[model samples]
Target: MIDRSDGQDEVAGIAVRIIKEGDRIADIVKNLLAFARDWKEEQGPALIQDILADSLGLVEKQILKDGIRFKTYISPDLPEIKARSQHIQQVFLNILSNARHALNQRFPGFHENKVLEIRSEVVEIEGRRYIRTTFYDRGVGIPGNIRDRICDPFFSSKPRGEGTGLGLSISHGITKDHSGRLWFDSVEGEYTKVMVDLPTVE
Candidate 1:
């Protein structure tokens, strides 16, 4: 009877493992489908602040794990913009994740004043109104020489087996598709700031 009981336990464990693997596969498929969705003409006016909150929520745990302090200065009454919510969320998540990774790489563990700052405002450039969002990280800044190539596909500063280097490239593409602009400024060994500018509905 003991042997039979042990066999049953083994089978149950295998079943449980299989279920977990299946769940993981399902999640991967869902993410892939979201990524492959066409963003060219999916223009819908969405609350930009709400999208930012949702994106930050998704990565809050990971941000906390590295002892990185996230600060936001979003404008309370920012106007709605035409954009795909999912794609905007993706853009923010990718930026936040990269900031966390960079902080970890520089400090390894928790350090005082390791901060990630996010800010948004309504700005005008050449007579056009835009909602400008900025993400700033006090971590390892990109080298000036290669800063221009940071958005190139498959370009990564991470070590082998760590990053595919496609995060920023995808982000750049998504921002462009929304008729927006994405760029960054960095002073090596100091800080890096990424900015996204999107047109607001009149």
Candidate 2:
């Protein structure tokens, strides 16, 4: 009960909220429960165009601001995929930000120019087409031990308390819900590449 001295009774007004909340203390759940509920009910995957068109178009400014050179190799005629649009967007953004932060901003940097690449391809497996998308960064790579649990909740390389540590786990779940896969390969002093593959809509 935070004190409110302005003659306004917030506690009295919240009586209805408490009564409606029943046995659950919704106030205690800090994370984005609303978003999580929305995700849980997404059921099926999002349409490919809905996820890609807007996301790719929107990241240009952020990339330039971070001095990251972006390159794309998407097939012009690549087919659609199924996914949760917002979650998928989150996955991409998370990876992009991680790559940006990996850059040696103040120390001796990689002699090579900083670069990021995204490529999309459609390939057939068992007579069905699957869309394979990959994101690669020419920045510092992740260590193997941490990579093993990259999708584990509450596991993050970022400084303590700076990250919720749920982004990768959420992204992994979204990939699974779409009947797809997400993986990455990295070398500590080399580069990192993240791949996402989904069955193309038939």
Candidate 3:
């Protein structure tokens, strides 16, 4: 038997992650095909739990590898929402990726305080019921001066080779298309919380 510290485990971990990523991409493709089939009709309702579970599965490895603590609170009784599940999953992926990047930027080495928390529940506003998923990250938060421009097209804090600055803009549009809302709040060095609200199905 080989010793665990010989980097064999690290190599295996990378292989596992690659396999998982491939599986996730295949799943995403299936969902996109389903969405295309129903393009002429209303996309339909998808359980918030299912969507979150899928999204989390895709990113959990990356989060763990980076030494970031990830936590979630998803209400068991939350109602399903009317929307394309794939699009919502994409939104979650994008933000999670951004959070991971921010945390890595702020704490290059293992940081005991790095945490990402996700909460999901049903909420009521003006007599309307909605499902909301809020993601909070203790990272180098968005600067106040550029907070308003964060979602604008072609705007990014990442270096040129790392990003195209279209993630948030596309996410914003997808949320709007589903009759939902995507917004965030942050303090430069404290934390950032992004909330996605989508109307629940009756």
Candidate 4:
């Protein structure tokens, strides 16, 4: 037979249920708050491909017509690392467009020495393969003082009204979320090399 004090157990059960409900409600509230703070734009992998294609199509005419020699060196065996293809495209388009802008600002004429080169290769570190992409341009390079802060949000070396400064910051965030790295090397009055590393699943 059950003890008469069994009411205590029933009350405890109800208290436990209340605690669980409270926890669930708290979790929901926290998730809603997070949603309000972040801009989630994770498109499908195919969409990223479309973004890449779109960037290539959009910039094909300008890069070649600018009279600045262009070159691309991609490793044939490098696999497409898991990434938002469109964001990747945006990153590249931004860099390429930036390259042109820097070159134009350097000289009025696109001489033989004025050129841009893009290269990609696979780098393996700690049993992980990464696609290392580099964008190099013989253009007026960024000043040392400002180059380090290029990825800082809302920090731009461009003239006022010319930049929002979010491009590189967004690109950096995307790379980081995909377990990658973004970096650059530049020397004023010489050249600049922007390197991006994306971890490959395989």
lDDT of 1 by residue, 34-113 (tens): 78865444679888899999998888987897789988998888999999888888889888888887778777877885
What residue runs in model 1 are displaced by over 4 Å at the alpha carbon?
Answer: 1-34, 38-41
Stretches of candidate 2 off by over 4 Å are 1-31, 40-50, 104-112
Best by TM-score: 1
Q: What TM-score does prediction 4 earn?
A: 0.73
Candidates 2 and 3 compared: the better one by lDDT is 3
CA deviation > 4 Å runs, candidate 4? 1-54
TM-score of 1: 0.81
Candidate 1 lDDT: 0.86
What's the lDDT for residue 5 in model 3?
77
Worst 10 residues of 2 by lDDT: 103-112
- Sum up the clashes in candidate 3: 0
- The deviation in Å at residue 4 for candidate 2 is 31
Instruction: Kindly list the per-residue Cα lDDT of model 2 for residues 1-202, writing each as its tens digit.
Output: 9667544566666776677554233432544576667677554445554566567667768766666777778787666676567777777767666666665432234434677788878877678788877888867788877889989986778864346677678778777877888899899867889888889766
lDDT score, candidate 1, position 43: 76
- Sliding window of 10 residues with minimal summed lDDT for model 4: 43-52
> With candidate 2 superimposed using the best TM-score fit, by how many Å does residue 188's alpha carbon deviate from the native?
0.8
Question: How are the candidates ranked when ordered by lDDT, highest leading?
Answer: 1, 3, 4, 2
Candidates in descending TM-score order:
1, 3, 2, 4
